[model samples]
Target: MAVPEGEISDALQVLRRVFGYDAFREGQGEIIEHVVAGNDALVLMPTGGGKSLCYQIPALVRKGVGVVISPLIALMQDQVDALRNAGVRAGFLNSTQDLDERRVVEAQFVAGELDLLYLAPERLKVASTVQLLDRGDIALFAIDEAHCVAQWGHDFRPDYLLLSGLHERWPDVPRIALTATATQATRTEIASRLNLEQARHFVASFDRPNIQYRIEPKNEPKRQLLHLLRTEHSGDAGIVYCLSRNSVEKIAEFLTANGIEAVPYHAGLDPRTRAENQSRFLREDGLVVVATIAFGMGIDKPDVRFVAHLDLPKSVEGYYQETGRAGRDGLPSTAWLAYGLNDVVNLRKMIDTSEGDAAHRRRLSVHLDAMLALCETVECRRVQLLNYFGQDGEPCGNCDTCLTPPESWDGTIAAQKLLSAIVRLDRERRQKFGAGHVIDILTGKKNAKVIQFDHDALSVFGVGSELRDTEWRGVVRQLLAQGLLAVESNYGALVLTDTSPEVLKGARKVMLRREPEPTKAAKAAKTAKERKAPVDLPSEAMPVFERLRTWRAAQAKDQGVPAYVIFHDATLREIATAMPSSLTELGKISGVGENKLAKYGNQVLETLTPA
Candidate 1:
């Protein structure tokens, strides 16, 4: 159905008055226009890019309810709550709802009282739910987190595989699929799986410049994480991701012991405990959550100050999506990672032992290699990250490499020496070894295995003594990233590949980065001092900001919702800086929508006033 001119004006009015945005963000208007014009779209926008507006406005302007297929129950609840706070008639149907609650929501949907209805994809599998949908007029179908439809994605949800039935059943309803992260390959897969081949594709820039990316070698990981929190992110909310539940629990305990409020979340935890912890992390201030990858999908928290990876993720897409969770309010947050060679070995072993065909294993390898390249790259991290998403740009000065550039040296001789050692060990012994044993032989360590293999007598033995053990390991990692070396799936041994002979024969030159030494003492001191400085707000506004935060905390507690759900720290900072007096003036603030102004305007004004 073509949107009438009056409805177009109404949509614009909704954008400004209801949502409190003076104008549409880049590409939002176009996507809204297309969807309102009754066309399908596939949207690939970054986190915090205002993606919800693209369909939400159209839902309001259209004739009936908008059906949103969300993957998580918590996410659906949060969205419905936020929409209701904005004065929109919204409700969700999920397993968490009781029979009476579901009946009420179903009645509202049937009565066309809800502007939007959020449903988990599994709900659509029920015949009764499908019939309920068939009886109502659905303005559009929104498939959020569309990347879950790709079978090869790290965050694949089996329920998402059943979403294509929407297209089959409601052929005339315009559908929009949206995700924060998707490669060209994954994009094609989503399109194919969702039957959105002809949908208009809106690929926004994947750069999240507000998040400063930093990857450091994992030396004394616990101490490093503590240092990061104490020195840089004290009194801020953040996430700490680990690869396993045990690690998450341990880290959470450690942080709690060190006087930081922290909680652990993983799939292995009991459902009630998990829900309570998640609610705590969302509702409380300055609470850190140490979790596995299972915890973060569809999280709508906007003020996560940082996302630190205690272990490496599976792929660049996974890393990007996880890190994108931070700085969603467009404030300066961090994406810090502690990565090392062991992460590489463990991940490779995981791929080898995983239940998949050779092709799938190869694809996993390609994904891991890309992630490794990002870790080992001497160039700008943001550029490499955007390049992975098929965008090209100049260096981003906010990342670690751009801030303190790593020195690159022509490691042609070093590469040859390492490759020569592998060649000699393979030629004489007909065997291979992991990087530790190989590095031992190179550094003249004379370990038991090196002596047993008589590798101490090789020509390449002790040739790498000029470089430190860490430097030698860097060479090995770079070679692996360059495809000159491959880990044998069966033995986890570093073996030569087709390209190794060229490096050994001096036919190719390799330029490798010299890993910088850790500067814990000096950097920690500087960071602590920097943390003491006020962020973005003037000194005069500090009191107002603190009072605003106190009020927000009380409001959030009373309502049982996240403080950010009321208004982000960024918006509060703006309010304190601008110091608006009246309701009319408060409405001019970015996040002060009509409903919020009506609800909290007097309280906010009173908070800003003196006693």
Candidate 2:
């Protein structure tokens, strides 16, 4: 079933007339070509890398409806809505739809009225659903968020494990599995589990240079978050991720109290309330979502200005995927985090106490260690992140490290002192203690526990008095990150690993990063300037942008959809900058597809016209 030459021309027309893009982004054309040729593909593209177009254009060019297996029901609706708005015949069937609605969509699919159909994986398990799908002509099977199939991934869905049935049932249909985040391990698991082992793999660059990475020590984290919102990301849409439901509620309340429009979202809330909060965050401009890990998968919002983490994430892959949600429109965005040693201890305790075999626990430990390394790395954050996914990149100047280089000092003595304290406490007292106790002993702080245990007279006691309390904490954190120190899972006790002996014997030299100074006024000013509207519209065009936004908001409200569904801020900025006077001129601008131009052309022109 090779695509005819004329159909290729039709695909290009759909790209321009329907999708409003003149040319294909990098790797999109290749993937589309392969799919149109009825080949399987495994695409590992970054967030905001235009992955939808890879399967979308090919679906239009081919003869049958494209069946996209999405994980989330909400995501399916969002995609279907966007496609319908673009004038594509797209529909979705999920649990949310009633039998009548499902039958209507099924009739449309059977009648060849739909260009694309979205389905949750669970639907494929039903005999009736399978019979319905079997009766239709499926163009290809496109698996969105393919990484969910990996058992080790953070967002693994039990339903995704059933996706392999697609290949077994419809061997003739070309399949394309796509995800925004996947490491080498996760990629292999996705390919193997989804029966895409023979599929051609396309691994795009994992770097998102538009996002500026910054990690600060947790000191009055709420105040720090407020400063970030007020000073850097004023009047912008963003997400705040906490580790617990209580924290999400409190933070959301705190933000709202401070005059910032914020909403809370977590699994603990009523489903309707969570849905409403998510809807508000999506529909309203400048509304922040304070949520836990339960939120933020498959979100299509493109103008999020920042993603702030109130606590440390579980793994590097998780951190990368979460932070990658920001600056998705290729605008300068920030990924700010406030973390301290408590995050490490808490995460370790979680891993240790969780039900798992030794092997499973070991894998979890490795993932956490990688995340901690990223947080503690003195080198380029982007480089470290990319390297974790098996990509090589130079220092990205946008990250905090490259912006303000931190001084590194040889911490061999500091390491020996800490290891010595751990070993002496264990051997002499037959007791294991956490970092705080070790630091107390090292800095000559004879608290009641130390005096009670007679640890005030240890040989290593007071040996590390030269370094401050914060500095010692840094050393211990780095040691844990480097695997020289391990936290016991059950009791949260710190223990030495095999690597600790090397540092204790002076065979290995340790380097620790000096904590960066507080954010200065000059730096804040520079960041504020950088966080302005991404478009380069002239000063005179500012009013036009505002007017366009107002019109878009009205349209979105009328349609009960997110404003970006009508037109993204980037598209509006383009329209304002270009100031196209005619429908033809408006269609020439990117993102103004033929359907949109026909639908809103007159309104846009009237808005642009002089009063």
Candidate 3:
């Protein structure tokens, strides 16, 4: 994607005048310039990496209204509001709107009064919607969340499959497909599915250095999550992801009971409740959202301080995307996950029972394997995460592993003992048991299930006495991850794979990552001390910052928009530090574009001034 001479000035002008950024971040200028010059593009940038600017700048600089195809209907209001706040004439037509509201936006688009018009992907299916668009000239088509085109992706949208025809219908309109998450395979599928194979592709580095990666072995996970919120991210906005709707509801209620302002979102919730909870989370400060992967796509909130996982995410792409929701403001944030053996077994069972051929199951297993490797890795979490997305990165000292590195040990004997126990149960007893029963037998615990299931007189029983229950569970988890062992499809019982023979024969040695112990507390406290502020806020400016936030909340309430639409935290940080005395001075700050300067500059000055 080359920036043609004399063409980028328009984009740079829009960047400064409309978006109020002095210059482009790493890869944005080229994408914007390429699209502005009537060329198609596919952009792959990390979340909060100025992805919107890649298309928004080109939309502002191009001739006709830029028609954007978006997937989330609930978010269109805020997205459009943010654009309108920055002085761009933006409107959206979604199912949430009444017929009258849709007509107004349609008229505006047809009249060429809107700089950008957003449509839900499903809307493109309507004959009337296509006819309405046919009546207006399109500047360019921007397909946002383009990764949804992947058939098996977690966020796949069937309506997105219709997008390939956009280029066919309007052959002259340059189309740019953009997404914050995609691997090379998903990227290729997107390009082919969207009929953009010829489009110039721009893939930005997937590293989000500001986010600290932390994956803890699951142990009283709800309590661990509470500790994380209370000690590190108290009174800060964040997202917590869970794998089930029941888990989402329970976690939300537990947090609320413990005095944290938490809300739940899931597909099972009524639409109104879901929308209200989402709006509240976005508009209010210091709120936490506990959800399945149903929430937090294209969430533009810049002040989110952490993203915690109560259960293991099934794939690295999802983990990265969900955690990428945090630290969007270029501020330090945490991506914390709590994983255990149950999570691994359950996800494998789900994939086995999942609808699809063997290929689909294999693809899913591949995703799960990568995720498991990430959780069990002794190396840097950030490095493994970046490498998963085909990017290289050094060990960032910010992640849990780099902060207090875990130890690796030859767990060959332990692994051999565990495998022997399973083998005896299968061969002699002619029965299979899940990890719990197996561990109970190995640790010689005469629990009720163990007693009911068997005579404890098995030969391999009690051989795993050298390691504690948790350590034995760790070995089982690693063996499962390493493909030497697997969960039975029907009952989730531990079963040996073909690779098990090599390990049993001592042909291959088993190495396992030893969990870092209580040193995590010291590391956490040090990290917490460093991340106390939103990011780089001086102590003297704290009062001004708090006062400004209060005023902004009031303004957002009056305007009925998310607070970020009024002024992002980054913008407010700049204002508080500068402590401008006049509207002229306030107007010069970044993110105070022309409309906002004229609209809110005086109020900002008044807020900064003494009462």
Task: Tell me each candidate's TM-score.
Answer: 0.95, 0.96, 0.98
| Residue range 113-168, candidate 1, lDDT tens digits | 99999999899789999999988989999999999999667688888989877889
Give each model's whole-structure lDDT: 0.87, 0.88, 0.89
lDDT of 3 by residue, 279-359 (tens): 999999999999999899999999899999988887888888899999898888888899998898889899989997999
Tell me the lDDT of candidate 2: 0.88
Highest lDDT against the true fold, candidate: 3
Better of 2 and 3 by TM-score: 3
Off by over 4 Å in 3: 1-5, 531-534
- Count of backbone collisions in candidate 2: 0
| Descending-TM-score candidate ranking | 3, 2, 1
Clashing pairs in 2: none
The TM-score leader among the candidates is: 3
| Cα displacement (Å) at residue 210, model 1 | 1.1
lDDT of 3 at 492: 88
Measured on C-alpha atoms, candidate 1 has an lDDT of: 0.87
